[model samples]
Target: MNMLHTQLLQLKPDDIIVEPSVTPLLAGRYRTKRRRQTLHTHKQFDDWVTVSGVQKRRQRSCKVCALLRGDRNKSYHTTFFCEDCSHGEAKCFLYPKARREYNGKRVVLQRPGKVGRRKKTRRELLQDGGAADDEEDD
Candidate 1:
């Protein structure tokens, strides 16, 4: 699957493996060695790869429009806003996923609490002067 493995499979039995400094014994084929590796690949090469995941959007700003606008551009709402406040200046805050700007401020989207709020403990209630009457009276 990797580049190196594909190259090794392409070699023929009689093919010579060249070394710059010195020759290696493994380079030459032996009489008993009938099998040789040949080059083959099932998948095409790619210049770019993508991963899937959830991300925050409101915390970062767009980078491409930043370069274009220089000091005039302001980033907010997970995007860049031009000096004129027009839609043209606004761009995708996320990088690599979209074709807009390659560089920019990152606006992370705010995430709400996934769990319920914690309740006060007995110790906290006692400290606040609400001790149990049963123990105190005894």
Candidate 2:
């Protein structure tokens, strides 16, 4: 039930309807899986309402910690929260079914190649002639 709620809160109305398609033969009537969206979540408050999105972390503070123990300095920081829900509340939530969905698009961002480089592989270092570009007429 908790997982269901977290997903609902993360909803954003896209310009195009991706969930369902009516392309006759090509499109599916229903969404097979949730697409990994890159959300730029930022930490609003220190402990109560923190956010994390598109950031890679090997170990995140467990979500269950908040459920077992109240949010009072338990340090079970959540990734994202609905602005409507957090407003005017004493604390964001006590035992929220905290779940994390990482943005897979991060793999492209973390590629070893330098930024602004082309998608294709670099040209061959050695040309047909044996003399490399660096060794030209110096």
Off by over 4 Å in 1: 1-86, 95-111, 114-119, 127-138
Tens-digit per-residue lDDT, 9-115, candidate 1: 98787797766887556644563666555322212112233436544323444454343333444643232222322335343342223333222443344332333
**Tens-place lDDT digits, model 2, residues 1-138:** 999999888888763376765665545756476766644233343433224855442333433444334334455544434343445653343224433322212232232333244544344433434465446756
TM-score: model 2 vs. ground truth: 0.18
Leading candidate by TM-score = 2
Q: Each model's TM-score?
A: 0.16, 0.18
Residue-pair clash count for candidate 2: 0
Weakest 10 consecutive residues of candidate 2 by summed lDDT: 101-110
Model 1 C-alpha lDDT versus the unseen true structure: 0.43
